[model samples]
Target: MEKAGSPLEQVRSSIAQACKRARREPGDITLVAVSKRHTAATIEPLLIEGHRHFGENRVQEAAEKWPALREAHPAVQLHLVGQLQSNKAEEAAALFDVIHSLDRPSLVKALAKAFDKTGRRVPCFVQVDVGDEPQKGGCPVSDLPALLTQARESDIPLAGLMCLPPAEIEPAPFFAFLDKLARDHGLEGRSMGMSGDYETAIMLGATHVRVGTALFGERPS
Candidate 1:
């Protein structure tokens, strides 16, 4: 039955199975349907079926797409799952319910100011470069404590930790390490994993899984 339904149903079934395998309730994890580069038409069917949580990588794209969707269905929750720029902090804060890429000190300052000015404390996940890739958009593991301190001092509501492991390697260790970091920091949210490794992430205590291609099919280049 799981294999015969729409993508949404299939993804939900998979989540349930993953949760059962991990000995955790399906409700313990938030499945964020990553809708970046997908059109509003592509998203409406899922929305019609009551999938409220959606993630967009770019604030501009979300702005272009979501206003109409939100107008029709007011309960949809939006998340910023991409690297954010300091210059777009206020716009991102106003548009997104959660920011998953709170990595650098500059962004910390920008988001803090935006929240302070707007009186909206958007929940943030401090992204850590667990893969230690210079190209990835995350704070180095060594610099994580300091960044967390700065975020705390700046009054950004720290939701938890987020990470992306290096490509072409086993992600379980990285996910495990991310869980440990969240544990050590007393954070309950671990926004790790994607379509490929979300089951493993759930087993490792991930509170949120950002899934894209698995649910929406492949993205165009």
Candidate 2:
């Protein structure tokens, strides 16, 4: 790995280069720094550097961590980028500014109720099981249409689609497929890509990339 400037700067430069090749403006892509397991101290530098978008995996962790952080950085936009339980709907709705794992009818209904109770409609990207991986938390491609309808009918503001491709394989095809899905659904936000293949994702029409390691370095195991 090359040591030059801050990790944040390196990631920004990489994103700009990717956008250049894709003929898209860097401003068009939202870089969601995944801060699931990171501490407030770890995240503060990025916040100080004017990075407003950050993603957390669990509602409880975000609730515990972000209140104080958001109090300081009022402009911060928090994104929930992990599997959300139906039971935690209201809390998740109130906490996250954006949701990237709305993948099923139950979650849709729960979020709808949550939105109604809280009167805050957070935009959500329906997670699609693009790789058909059983272990992943996403709506199967066959069930996506119905789930989408349910979400819309429940009044959940659809941001677009999100996915995690099968690991250790060429991800371009999966990213391209997600872009096609977004196009077919007439949605503009394609939340695909991560630390490893975000460049390919940009080329394939990723409007949002959930990157962790590239920005914050590896989380301690």
What TM-score fits each model?
Answer: 0.97, 0.97
**What's model 1's TM-score?**
0.97
Residue runs of model 1 more than 4 Å from their true location after superposition: 1-4
Per-model C-alpha lDDT, please?
0.92, 0.94
lDDT of 2 by residue, 8-93 (tens): 88888989999999899999999999998899999999988888999999999999999999999999999999999999999998
How many Å off is the CA of 31 in candidate 1?
0.5
Clashing residue pairs found in predicted model 2? none
**lDDT of the structure predicted as candidate 2:** 0.94
In angstroms, the error of model 2 at 23 is: 0.7
